[model samples]
Target: MSERVEWDDLPADLRSAVEARTGKVVAAEGIADGLNCSTALIIETAYNGPLFLKGVRRTDEPGMAALRCEERINATVGGIGGVSPAIRHRFDAGGWTALAFGCISGRHADLGPGSQDLAAVAATLRRTHDLPVPDFPLPQFADRLRTFLRPGEAQILQGSHLLHTDTNPHNIMIGDGGGEAYLVDWAMPAIGPAWVDPACTAVRLMECGQPPEDALAWLGQFASWRRARPSAIRAFVDATCRHWTATVGDKSAEPSNSRFRRLLECGRTETA
Candidate 1:
């Protein structure tokens, strides 16, 4: 997660553009849980109530592109029941591209072992797996990670199912009254096997104190998980561990590196 821009520091024209859609901005609070955006805030308008605003300067090509990708994914998945927030408005102005989503009065899911939120998380995964492939160009999950996988490992990553690759518990919002879990931040979506998202979730479960076997067991209810080939699972675990190891680099003492190491170890234990 990155520190975001303060509302007061936002460009006047961009603020105006957002306010145009939202009415007078009575209150704006920064949200500090996302990594790429230049700005992420919750705003309360005189008329529009509350909305979550996320934006990045056009100058940041990668960040800007991510925002646009999220917007597109939201639109495509918006009608697929209750998996994501509704996009209220999207616009570019003052050299910034931004989107406002209907605010979710929810908290980040607690993905630790035995947490009740796991059920909602599972349900969300089920609905997401059932969605038809979006009718737009998306990077193939296998192709995106081909360089990190062994010769035959990438084969299992190929499929038409839409995947939300970043399953950090923070990206999953559990409703205030224990309603449906909503997946947020759709920037890195991929088309892959339906099991990919749950596999990613399994990694996070390791982060949250479950061993790989227990984590996989927790997700056994998903048809995708039950039907996944053992080879594919091993490949996914190996490639993911390798990817994170490469990402964490020589800083083996770093906290993130330690977490990745645990996940890597879990994968090794399961497959050995």
Candidate 2:
């Protein structure tokens, strides 16, 4: 996640534009969750309660493109019955681009042992897998992971299904007294097999205290998981181990890497 960029640090016109629609920004607090945004804030407005805002300099091509992708997806994803924050406003000018979403009044999900949020998180994952593929462009999941895997491994990961590949605990918000869960930050979305999100989430569940076997068992509720080929799942495990290796660099023994290795071993044991 990126460091917070204060509201006052925003370009004068950009801030003014946001305020015009949101109505006098009474209080702005920086959000430190998602990585792509240069500025992420939950602001209190004179007229409205709070609007979640994210922005980046227009010159930042990558940042702008990502925000734009999020903006486009929010409409479709939010329609899935509280699956995402609805975009309330959008600002493009003053050498900056920003989006404002209805603030989700809750904390990030806790994906640990016996947590109440597990069901809601699982429900959210089910909704995400059922999401309609938007007509706009999106990169394939295999393509994104291809750089980390050997040539043929990425193929089994491809599909027509819409995927929210980065649904770690932080990105899954548990609101309404922990009974509701919403997926945030569609910036890293992709088109892939239906099982992709669950597969990634299983490892995260492990990192958050679920044993490898327990994590794999948790995924059993999803039909997609049952339909997932053993070979494809194993390939994903291999690619993800490589992913963490690349991400952690020389720290091949990093805790995250170790988690994936355990997950790999667990899958192997199931098929053995």
Taking the tens digit of each residue's C-alpha lDDT, what string does model 1 give over 120-202? 89889988878877777899888877878999778766888889889998899988865679899999999988987986787
Task: Using lDDT, give the best candidate's number.
Answer: 2
Tell me model 1's lDDT, rounded to 2 decimals: 0.80
TM-score of each: 0.89, 0.91
**TM-score result, candidate 1:** 0.89
Error of 2 at 58 (Å): 0.8
lDDT of 2 by residue, 1-272 (tens): 55557999888899889888878998989777778988998899987789888888888888888898998888789743748989988898678889888888899888889887888888888888787898898999888768777767777777888899898888998887557889898888899889888877887899889988888888778888777766667777777777767776757647776666654443433343
Backbone clashes under 3 angstroms, per model: 0, 0
TM-score: which candidate is best?
2
Q: What is the lDDT of residue 216 in candidate 2?
A: 80
